[model samples]
Target: MSAEGEQYGSSEEEDMYSDDGQEMEEDEQGEAPAAQAQPVLGPKEWVGLASMPAATQQALLNALGKLRGRNVNEMTVIFIGKQGVGKSSTVNTLLNERVAPSSPFQPENVRPLLAGRMAAGFTLNVLDTPGLLEGDSVSARGLMALRAALNGRKVDAFVFTDRLDTWRVDNADRAIFTALAENFGAELWERTILGFSHAQTTPTDGKPYEQFVAARVEQYRAAVRSTLGMKNLALPYVLIENGSRCKTNGDGEKVVNDKPWVTDMVSTMVDVASVGEGYEYDHSKAGKKLDPNNKHKIWILPLFLIQVFVLRPLLIGQIKRDVKKAESKAKGKK
Candidate 1:
């Protein structure tokens, strides 16, 4: 087996490569033009707004109001990350409604879900996607599913969710950054907001909470930079605690590290959208498909030519010379 096979497996049905070939072919050929922006028929009312603390509600309204000032009446945000990383819970917390089914023990299905909410003549659409990783590799099936869900819709920003309690970032974490850049485009990163969920955890390293948060943010920023080769990538981050046990401030707003995380998260989303235009899905921007089996096969022709033209001729001449020497020696002896 080749080195890639040993590392990722040779099976055609391997999780990383499964269903990716077709998706990549479609991408390479350029899928249909960006779908027309269809209205989210009969969006649900923002009932959760009334339940939020008055201060948080006003803060959210004020942040979204800035988007209105920019004439962006409708905003769409997508959530993506590894499985069971509180993606759905974050969505629920942000919208203040249980629109996406979430569970700690069981991972959601591979299907993507879109939930739209309307408030004060503004529309907010959130797309919750399946986990992007399967085992140690990026799951092509999950990417394919997310692409289908998007269907060329314009996205204002992306919320990349992960657990803050996890101390280490591994190759799998970096692979996600590469996969996203390859499948969707490097431009997506510019509009992405790093959402560190489970933000209410105590630092086991005995570091100050702010210091620990800063270190964690830098770790992920470095990963994104190294993986995507974007050394200057500026990633805006939001600390999130999706648990019901999260502490509340005097105004009844959920607080993480004494800050109203929900308000800050929403404000950051608005900031991301205001900085750039909405990202419309374009398959043409996708990177060329990588064939794992044929990745390093370019050396095959050169090696083959050496074996047949150079090595074969040398071997044949050597054999004839040896045979003639043997015959001459036998005749002399006779």
Candidate 2:
């Protein structure tokens, strides 16, 4: 079979026609295939469909010929981490625009905010959260606000941001991961991607990427993985150096190298952001099916009428009765 033909087949057939088909067959029958056996479609292929014009839907179908895999739908990416970690910068880069503000905020300190847009008919929302250790008294309130913002929303993936140079095995990072797991459930860990920003801070020794990941500056990576019960604990992560500097010549013309880490980091962000394929966003359905317009609005009309006509009067009467009871109790106590 041709390569295109094989692309449209089951795993068994896809492997059977390949160079290591025999090995895959044996592994399938006796033991599970290695984790690396199944090739993950690259980030480019995943996002290609969404980037295509919707008017080309028929042409896309004919050219691709019955896509065997999933489709990208409404995706939400939440950036959670410490202060000054470039969460907003990463978000702006992924969006390829300045949709998110990057400058720091004071007073109450930087807090989480939600920004959304519709791209290629897919509604994409990215939530930028405040640092885990912003204030002492606002922890519970911050958590509640985070929950409220995420309420009635289906999160497809989370981008956990941390600083490679400033990371530490501290309570703040631990609390952040704990709160994340508690709120989103541990399953979200699998969908999580650790983004280590400020890679330029590392020494210019030109070491391998693997060595950088091994240094364990803060253990944020390991801590989050362990919290999620991941056995390997390495977890997939990306390193980025977002800050840039430029030098000017006599003519006041400036040249830039940008940040070397930016390329790889952007690639990884694209991958993490692309995971929302095949998932729909319908807040009314508890994350099932696309809501599409105000179709669900009709279902609430009768309930609203009942509340207005019957429940409201009953609720008022109950409030009056409770107030009388409280007054009687106060008198008896006196």
Candidate 3:
């Protein structure tokens, strides 16, 4: 597969594309309308939601669930991704505010930022984490802070991010997935959903956008399955198009996200929490070195330190530096 676009096999059923083909047929000028403010669910409305139609009810439920405090219960979710993949931007969008720091120049290395907002019967506790680097594992001390934030609540879902236009899975990506599997166990994959940044826009690749997206999704799915050595498994996914790129679609419309993507994101998290019966926060495995006695390999200690302490930090610094330089060059030329 090409470095720019990771290719994967096959296709599947309906996704976000099927619903907006007609709307996308027209190119809108300027930014898409900002998301409309969500209404708070009063006790009466909360009680009334049950009687509304399925779609409307779910939509409202998702909205109220995100609002910070309204006597609602909470579901905690951790956002995981390599740095600069729009994790912070997505988090800001979710909170309808700039709660998370984000910029195009570089990834934020800040510690995990946790906050809880409650409405009706839903409480959403979002933990925005530092980007995952190969061999860069969480410290036991960091996990302690995370567990303390939970107040004993289970982490319902682990949201992993990628660009919608990314078409290939690299070796580094595979390693990150393997680390996650080992830390959370093979079961965490069950509660995972591939959250795509820039969900509304697609890059031109000599083919239709939808076709490209389908292929990319498959490639990502295959990568995860292969990492886990499982041939028959599909990861849950959601797409949120949040970017500055203005592009043309076959529909002749400039790609713009009006808010459905965010709605879907919240709803999906709720579903995972409900399904998993709540994923508890467990960091006992943090800072774990490779087993020295594993039949899989011998002499893993020095290798572990090199991976975690030496190589990982160097890679992280170089990436951020490159991103900043690229952004600076683009600005100067413009």
Candidate 2 lDDT by residue in tens digits, 25-105: 213433222222242231122232344334333333332222212354445667776667788676654444443457566
Candidate 3 lDDT over 142-190, as tens digits, reads: 2222223333346778788988867678877887677666655666677
The TM-score between candidate 3 and the true structure equals 0.59
Candidate 3 residue spans exceeding 4 A from truth: 1-72, 105-107, 134-152, 244-259, 281-287, 290-334
lDDT of each: 0.75, 0.49, 0.56
Error of 2 at 149 (Å): 2.5
Candidate 2 has an lDDT of 0.49
Q: By lDDT, highest first, what's the ranking? A: 1, 3, 2
Q: Cα deviation of 161 in candidate 2 (Å)?
A: 0.6
- Which candidate achieves the best lDDT against the true structure? 1
**Steric clash pairs (candidate 2):** 71-278
Residue 211, candidate 3: C-alpha displacement in angstroms: 1.6
